[model samples]
Target chain A: MLEGILTGLSTATMPVNLFMVFIGCFVGTFIGMLPGLGPISAIALMIPITYGLDPASGIILMAGVYYGAIFGGSTSSILINAPGCSGTVVTAFDGYPLAQKGQAGKALALAAYASFTGGTISAVFLLVAAPALASVSLSFQSADYFALMVLGLSAVAAFSGKGNILKALMMTVLGLMISTIGTDRSSGVDRFTFGRMDLVDGISFLLLAMATFALAEALMSVLKPEDNGEADEDAMRNLGSMKLNKEEIKEVAPVIARSSVLGFFVGVLPGAGATIAAFLAYGFERNLAKAKEKLKFGLGSLKGLAAPEAANNAASSGSFVPLLTLGIPGSGTTAIMLGALISYGIQPGPRLFLDNPEVFWSVIISMYVGNIVLLILNLPLIPYISRLLAVPRQVLVPMILLFSITGVYLVSFNSADILIMVIITVLAIVLRLLDFPLAPLLLGFILGGMLEDNLRRALLISDGGYSFIWERPITLTIFCITLFVLVAPLASGMWKKYRKKTVGYGASMQE
Target chain B: MTISRDQIAGLVFLVFSLAYGFYATDIALLPGEEFEPINARTMPYVLSGLGAALSFFFVLASWRSAGTLKPLKLGLMAWPPVIALLVVMVIYGLILNWLGFVVSTALFLIAGFRIMGERRPKILFGVSIPFVAISWFCLTQLLDIYLAPGRLFSLLGG
Candidate 1:
């Protein structure tokens, strides 16, 4: 094990790997600072460049971008109310309010520290959990994998919330349908190529991801004119000058630790990405606070800022475990990585460990190095990034839209992809206007292919026997967990409504 | 504030998807005798069925919640961009093979910018020229990805 660790470290320390790490972090931070761009878009844009590099270096660069982007996301949330990405939405709860109060400096400092803490702690967890999970996955048959995919899909449904259950289900189904657009994997027959030669290999996950998330977001931003008042004179203050008091540090440290653990677990769950983890962490933190104390949450509670910041970063790290071990992606970013790995002739499974220990362990070591580098880079640079808030929305929006168009077009050099992007963008705009959540749609799109592939594979193995779903202990356990997740929320909501009715009746009788 | 629009759209999408799945299943040839009967199309069919059922449920739910479902009000700027995107996409689809990436993309970007109300000729030329140049160089020269430089550009040694 020690020899393996040393080998990994030596490989990651090479100048090429180091340079890619910096480049990824630098590009990631800038992209994350852009209000509408996310890691998905950043990765999509960068994938074209990676075609020229070695697989390890390419992977390292992408990883750097991923971690850097997450950290950079907090800059916008802190300086302005706008979160650059969904994962940073929780940061905006406290971050923007602090900026408004002329303590943007303090909030920015605390956010950086909290991010570092969360990322480092989660990196440690990943180091421990990933190898352990990979070992356990060595024992998994096709049956176990099939069950895991079902669990992943069901978990997405549960996390999607009951209010838009149908839409979420529809999105999931649509995703599965879209995944079937290329040639049949098991058979040589064309499924839905529609005589288009470009689609014979299937709709690239990279393109679909860009369309669903990046282009859709850019369109949404364009349709709704953003309030530029956030960039008013007060936004220009330097955040580096501020320091967190010892008391503030003490208050947030526990929150960071608790959220780090919570975030790691949330990330480990398929379909529950950083946004949900952060939101869940904030809700938990709020409940722990007093009623009056809760007032500080969205208005710059240190814990509020720390919890989600920690959780989201941890979730980001945790997302890789399933992808690396089980060959299943827990989030869209990881899904794209999975696609990239496959494109590079590297199949991510149990054999990934036995066949390529250097690839697996080196990637892990690089993540740790990336986290440390991000901390060092972001701490001093907070003030500089905070200045990004001053860029006018008029200018910024146009630039972002241009980048989106260019980026999407660059991916496949296909005009058809641009059209698909535009259509999805319009759909997203319409959906947003109607108050439907976009995250679930994205979640569905990411998981749809996995769910379809696994369900059929499982059935093929079982020979249409329903008993296989229950007979496998792991499958049964996952199914039960999914059932619990689905039913628990509805039960709690109904109980609350029932309690309210009873209380109202008692009040009427008293009157 | 017709709730039916949502339901109808959902139903149409669901039905089309189901048809597509059935068609896919019909075309799919199974693997070797070593494998079971279930093939690639089975899961798609299952998902399509689930989608159709969910769409029906959505319609029912919309009807049940009619009293509570709020009317959707779109912004003023919404329709123009949507229509422009649709029209441009159709046109681009047709002209892409004929005109190639350079001519098509320039026209698309310029028109898109105009639609967004950037009327300054200097701004238009400024953004358009650099965008075309950089995109061409990066995609063609740096990355080595083959882009359709159009018949006109091909004649000029593109």
Candidate 2:
């Protein structure tokens, strides 16, 4: 393992690899600075560009984009209360408030530092944990994988929050249904093609993702008015001198450490991703902090800002574990990476370690280097990047819309894809207006095919018995944990309500 | 906007999916292998069932939550971009087969810039033409992805 780590570092030190790292970070920061453009879109846009490159170089560049985008996302969120990506939404909770308080520079600096610490530590964890996980994954049968996918889907629903449980389930079901739109893989007979040649193959996940995220977001941005004079000029002036005091650092350091560990673990779980990790980390930090004194969490609390910033960056690194080890993507960004890998004929699985150790380890090594590079870039470049918020929304939204359409069209070279983009974008707009969570919809689309494939294969192997999920200890353990995550919240919420009612009744009787 | 809209859409999708699922089951030819009884239709049928259940859930939920609907504000200025996109897509679709890659993209970008309120025609043409040329070279000349070459471009041995 030690030798492998050294080997990985040596490969990453090559000039070509180093140059790719810089290019990826530069492109990633630019993409990440753009509102509503996340690592997924950036990577998706670049997949065709990487198609001609070597596999290791391609993977390293993409990994650099992924981690660098996480760092860049914090800048927009802190500056303008606009989360450049879903993972950075929690950062905006406290980050924008800090910006409002004229401490944008300090918040940004701390964010970069915390991101660096979280990312480096998590990369080390990934190096240690991925090989062990890969070894264990070697034992996993089709049944175990099937159970695991179900657990992943259920966990997405559970973590999607309580208000949207039914909608999330519906979206997951819809995604699974969409996954079956092509010809039957085993039977070689058309299933839901409706006699169209294009339908012979299923709808592309990339197309669906672009439609849902990029197209939908662009449309939504157009519908929203441009911010003309929201931010205070006085606050902007004060930002020139903003810096974190020593006392603030002493308070935030432990929270960052704890959240980093917590976020990494949450990210290791399939379908949870960085957003949930950040939220959970923030919740943990808030609950653990001094309760007697009212801590201004959600309003420029340094701990609140640091916890999620650290957690999400760690989560970004943690998410790569399943993708590299088991060929499962833990988030939307990783799913796009998986798609890009497949397009390059590089199948990511347990055999990846033996077959392409350089590809695996070099990409991992680039992640560490990418994080350090981003820290340097973000700390000094915050003011410049923050200036992006001053651009008129009218000008920006149209350009984004134009690029989105062009990008989607360029990828498939199919007119039908453009039409699909419009349809999905409209659907997304309606869904968003209805208050449905878009992340669950995306999570569903991603895991739907894998879940269907694995479930069918498992049943075939088990000879149609449903008992396979319970027979395997690993599968059963995952199922139990999934059940716990789902049921725990409902049970606790009911219990709390019950206690409150009883206490009220007792008080009335005493009165 | 109404519970009926949600219910109707859900029911329509449910029926469509059910029909498709049944048709798919009939079309699918199961293997004669002794080891496994499950076939391709099993997963589709399962998904169909889930879809049907969710459609019903949507109907129920929309009914129960009907009163909770809030008024949504729409920005009027947003319509122009949507219309512009629609227009660009139509134009692209129409020209892609005839005008091909370079000409179509340049025209599209130029028109797109104008529609988005860029008034400097010189800048528009200058920026767009080179972009189209580069995209043409990269996609067709280098990567070997077949793009439709314009009739005019073909005269130049494209």
Candidate 3:
């Protein structure tokens, strides 16, 4: 472990990697400050640029962007009451109120402090946790892997909130269906090309990511046109003192610690990610608060703003655990990173650290470095970054549109890809309107090939019998977990319904 | 008689799955490969069934809540710009081969800016052309990447 840390320190401290981290954070902050472009889209936009670099630098750049974007989102949420990403939505609840109260600088400062602590703490926890998990998972077999992918896919839907469970699952199925479009690698059999040569490769992950996320999101935002930057400009003029006196620090200290720990654990869950982590931490803090403090939560309580800022950052750090150890991305943002890592020809799984120590440890170390850079660099630069983001949507949106399309075209040099991207963008916009979660679709598409390969291997090993599912204890345990994850939600929902009926019947009897 | 948005989604997916399943049968398999435990046909068959089943359940669930669920409504969302932008993107795609990277991208950005109500020729021409030129330079000179010259240029050169 010490040796690995040293390896990471050496790689991450290199001038180029450090520069990548800086550039990533700056760009990430800029993009994340833009309403409607979340970390996923930010990361997606970087995919093309990162294609020119080495794997470690590429990933380092992305990790920095991920953290920077989250921090930037909080900036928007505080200053303008418009959250740049879902993870920072909770930040705005208290943050915007604080900004309105002439404590915009304080809110920004506190959010930055919370994020730095959260990121640093979780990076430490990850330093200990990731290697242990990777070593254990090194023994994962085909059956176990198949079960794990299913669990990951199911968890995405199960955790995608209440009404969209079925829709998310449908998207997952659609993703899988799309994944089967190209020829089958194992048997050399063409499946769904429909005689089109472009169809043979199915779809490019970069293109899908760019289209569905960057292009679709940019276009989707265009559907509801933005104001002429008046609100942002107004908010920028009065930024109050950034200093947090001893009293303010003391008040939020425990909240930050509690939320950071809670956020890390939630982020370690397969699909919970940072948004849920921030929400959970906010709720938990509110519930723990005294009556007076509780009332102050949405009215700009220091603790309230600090709690989510800390938690979301911690959760963001915790998310990388699965990506490194299990090769399953915890959320849509990480899913795109997973796709990028795969394109770099580096399979990030149990073998990640063992095979690519520089890549692995460098990423982990760069995350911590990225956090420091954000605090020392971006916090002070927020006002300027926000102003830059005020570039009118008329100009900004088209530039983003240009980048989104050209990003794909440059990679393949195929004009047809541009056309295909248009189709996918339209489909993505329609699906977004219909309220289908597209993350699962991307995750499913990414995992589809691996899932099929594992299942096929498991079947072949068992002589075509399904017994391997139950035969291997590891596989059985994973499948059981998947079953629980899938069934528990429905069972609990039904139980609630039954309880409601019984309660209603008793009320009727009394009447 | 009002099919909710969820129902429409479900119905579309259901039809897609059925069509996908139909096509799954047409996938060519090596002789004796079909007997294998898992082949090209295996995943498609499973995916189609899963897709069909999920969509069927989704449609049924939506239908069960027919009165409660809202019908599909996209009227409030601004349509002209979205439609224009999408068309602009499609045209951008078409013109790339004919006009090359610099001209087509510049045109696309200018047009996109115009559609979004940026009428100032200064902002439009000034931003689009220079940006495209810089990018073209970066790709061609810095990255040493080849952006194919326009087809018209190629014809002239030949």
Candidate 4:
């Protein structure tokens, strides 16, 4: 493990890799500061640029971007009360109130510190957890893999907000269906190409990612024009002394520590991502607070701010565990990363541990560096980066659209791809409007080929009896978990209802 | 009954799945492949069935659930510029083969800016021209990715 860490340190410290990380963080911060764009879109936009680099550097760059984007999201949340992504939505609860109280600097500084601590601790945990899980998953058979995929999909659907589960599952099915468009990998026969050569390779992951995330998000902003309101340009200029007194630090220190642990564990769950982690951590901290301090939660409580900031960053690191070890993405952003990794011809499963230890370890090491970079480099630049928010929507929107389409165009240089992207974007926008969760579709699409492949192998091993699922204890355990995940939402909803009736707006509803 | 957004999406997915299932049969299987445990059609068949069932339940879940079901809010959107932007994107795709990267991308950017209400010619050409030039230079010169000159240029040169 020490040797592997040294190897990772060497690769991560390489001039080019370090430069890529810097560039990724810079670009990611910029993109993420925008009100509408999220980390998934930010990473998707960067995917084209990473194609020119080696896999290790590429992944390192992406990891930096993921952290940068989250940090950047927190900045906007603090300065303007407009979170760049869902993960940072909770950051705004206390952060914006701090900004309003002329403590914007303190809030920003606290966020950076909390993020740094969370990222560092979770990186340590990931270092231990990822390899341990990798060693165990190394023994995963085709049946086990198929069951894991099922669990990943089910968990995603189950956690996709209260009413969105069915919609999310439908979108997952839709994504899986879309994945069958081109030639079947195992059979060497076309499935739904309809005699089109473009369909021969099916849809490129880049195109779908760009369309659904970057392009669709850009267009949806234009289409719907969400009124997130605006930030006071003057308030941003003077962020009011970015310093934390000893007492302030002492107060939030324990909160940050606790949230980091909570966030890491939640992130390790198959479908729970940073957004849920931040929300959970914030809720947890609020519950722990006394009545007076609890009242300050939505009104610039340092503990409230620190808790989510730490948890979200820690959860970001924890989410990588499933991606690195199990090859199942815990979140939508990682799903895009998984796609990019596969495109690099490097599958990110247990085999990745042996075949590309450098890629695995370097990512873990670089995450720590990424967190440090976010703190040292980005904290000071928040004032200037926030100024970028003033850039005319007219210019920025077009530029983003151009990047989104050009990203796909540069890859295949095919004109038809742009058309397909637009069509998909249209469909995606409609679905978005309909409130069908797009992440599951993306996750399902990414896992679609693998799921089918594993199922086929499992069936083949079982001689078409479907017994491989139940015969293997590991596979059965995973399938049982999947089933439990599917039923959990209904059961929880019922419990909540019963509790509400009996307890009369119980403590559960308070947080 | 007035259909909600959920019902609409469900119905559309249901139809799409049926069509997909119908087309799955047309996928040519090898002589002995069908007799095998799974073929190219098997996954598609399963997906189609799942999609149909899921969409069916989705429809049923929304059926008469009026309190929670959001009515489609299509009228709230500013459709003209969005539709115009879509047209601009499609046109950009069409013209790219003829005009190549620089010209088509410039036009796309210009149109996008314009649709989004940017009328200043200076800003339009200023951003698009320099941006395209740098991007083109980077791709062709620095990166060594060959982007052929537009068909019109090729024809004229010949």
Output the number of the DockQ-best candidate: 3
Put down candidate 4 lDDT per residue, A50-140, tens digits, no spaces.
8999999999999999998999899888988889899999999999999888899999999999999999999999999999999999999
**TM-score comparison, 2 vs 3, better candidate:** 3
DockQ-based class of model 1: acceptable
Tens digits of per-residue lDDT, candidate 2, A137-237, equal 98998878777777767667666643556666666666777777787666677777778886687787667776777666666666664452456434434
Clashes of 1: 1
Give fnat for candidate 4. 0.81
**Candidate 4 CAPRI-style tier:** high
Instruction: Give the candidates in order of DockQ, highest first.
Output: 3, 4, 1, 2
* DockQ of each candidate, alpha-carbon based: 0.48, 0.47, 0.84, 0.81
TM-score for all predictions?
0.89, 0.89, 0.98, 0.97
Question: After superposition, which runs of candidate 2 have C-alpha atoms over 4 Å from their true positions?
Answer: A226-247, A291-293, A388-411, A489-511, B1-26, B30-36, B75-77, B137-146, B151-158
Greater-TM-score candidate between 1 and 4:
4
| CA-lDDT, candidates in order | 0.73, 0.75, 0.90, 0.90
DockQ score, prediction 2: 0.47
Clash pairs, candidate 1, are: A105-A239
Model 1, position B66: C-alpha lDDT score: 64
Every model: iRMSD: 3.2, 2.9, 1.1, 1.0
